[model samples]
Target: MSRKLLIDIHTHLYLPRYAQLLRARSQIPRITTLNGEERLVILAGEAATGRPVGPSYWDRDAKLRFMDTHGIAISIVSPANPWLDFLPPAPALQTCEALNSDLEEYCATSPEVELGGRRRKRLYGMGYLPVVPGQEVGGVCAAVEALGKLPHIKGVILGTQGLGKGLDDPALLPMWESIAKAGLVVFLHPHYGMPPEVWGAQENGHVLPLALGFPFETTTAVARLILTGILDKLPALKLLLAHSGGALPVLSSRLASCIAHDPVAASRLAHDARYYLGRMWYDAVAYGPEELAFVVPTRGTDRLLCGTDHPFFPPLKGEEMWMSVTENLDAVENAPGWSEGEKEGVRGGNAVELFGL
Candidate 1:
């Protein structure tokens, strides 16, 4: 039997150059040495207990090893969160270029990477663009153009906060146009999920913030994009939303209903909110059969792509295969009423088409 191509659209890595930059910084989003090992601390809230650092983050061998062990055939990796968002324009530009180049090289040089037993181009990348403060639409456009030129960069991963303001910023329209012109997929990912106040005084843990906040942030951003008519303006722009397009597939109808009820919002877009929802791709990072089932009907199997947020939500035991990956794979296979061929599409086939893999 032929092995089905299993592509992970959501794996993350800290490119060596990018990780170096992070290590040099002294603030949140910086790497610090602890007990003879490096740990990456992104959010200020999580600074006290930073994520464990190892080769799984910046080393290509480690990434390939995990992919091999987990049966992942191809991984379109992007930088981890808070990517180049804190740097100044000049530094950010240099950093973005270096990181993009490094990411491309990492993939291009890995075509011979042996997965399980055979050689394959198992590692690919989504490039980073420096759209921090002071980087205007023109700079962003240039960055987007430069990013698209990278041979292995299938797309550009963007945070919810684009150029300080949200993605619905009018200032980003030109950048959007440029990206559309390049025919690059924009992976809309969430970073700063929500305000601390939203978690309430009783909540001191990250469970509420990461679980509820991240998806909420993505849902709000995509909803705003649809309602603000960005989707209408850039109808051709390909958007891939992380975390199963957040809670969008389930909440699309309610968002559409709100748009219909609100006079201003209703007139802003040419189509209902759910119509634009169909125009995008969603990652199968919801982590369950039921969640995948809910998302499948809403986005359709073709638009659903598999992903494992590797190295971050990896298995706690060092030797164990990542539960995050297995669960997502199982979810795709077990999605209600889906045939093997249909499940295969979500598992990797859709990502192959989405990223031109």
Candidate 2:
């Protein structure tokens, strides 16, 4: 029998060089020196206790070890969130180039270093984009074109904010067109959670925002893209939404109803509300079997891919496996009406086929 090939489509890595740069900065979202100890802190809620930060974030060997233990055959790595978005124009552009080059090289070459008495299988990566400093549409198009040529890069990982405004902004069309023309899939991930005011007085560490805010932000961004006719304009553009499209599958019907009721939205949009929803792909990271069942039918099983948001949700106290990852795997295992072949696709085959791995 063939082994169950597992591909973690949504894993993250903070390259050691990049982490060093972040550690030197003394900012809210950056690393800081407190009581003579340097630590990294991002979310405000997690600032008090401070989450653990270390080599597991950067060292490639650690990633290999984790994958070996977990049975993950391949990982499509991207730089963790808040990438280069905070840097100035020149620096951001340079950083983006360097990271992309580093990722491409890393993916294309096999490391001489071996772990667990065996050299690891080839790893792959998606390049990062400098969408913040709001580059001119020409510059943005050029950058996308450059990334598309890199041998190991399958796509670019983008945040919700597109060129400063949300993804729906009209100014981003040229960049979208260039990306579509390049035939690159856009791996849409989330960074900005919700407006802080929405979280209320909760100081529950990063739990509330990381779990709920990330997905919500992704859902809103994609919906806006649909509403603004971006999807209609670029039918060839393929998008992979993180966290099972961040509640989009569950709320699609309501979105359609709202669009039907609101003449403005209906008139502006070129197609039915759910038209673009079916065009995109989703990661199987909804945290439960029921959530997977809910999303698969909505997005279609072929478009669903499995992911482990590793390093972010490591084993909590007394937990042998990550609740985040196990829940996702179990979801695919138990999702109702999935034939064994469909389950195999979601497990990893879909990504292999979609990304041309």
Local distance difference test, each candidate: 0.84, 0.81
Clashing pairs in 1: none
Worst 10 residues of 1 by lDDT: 111-120
TM-score of each: 0.95, 0.92
Residue-pair clash count for candidate 2: 0
lDDT of 2 by residue, 251-302 (tens): 9989999999999989887777777788999899887778877776656899
Residues 101-164, model 1: lDDT tens digits: 8888899998554444556577788888888877867878898898778878888899988888
Best by lDDT: 1
RMSD of each: 2.4, 3.3
Q: What lDDT, from 0 to 1, does candidate 1 have?
A: 0.84
For model 2, the local distance difference test gives 0.81
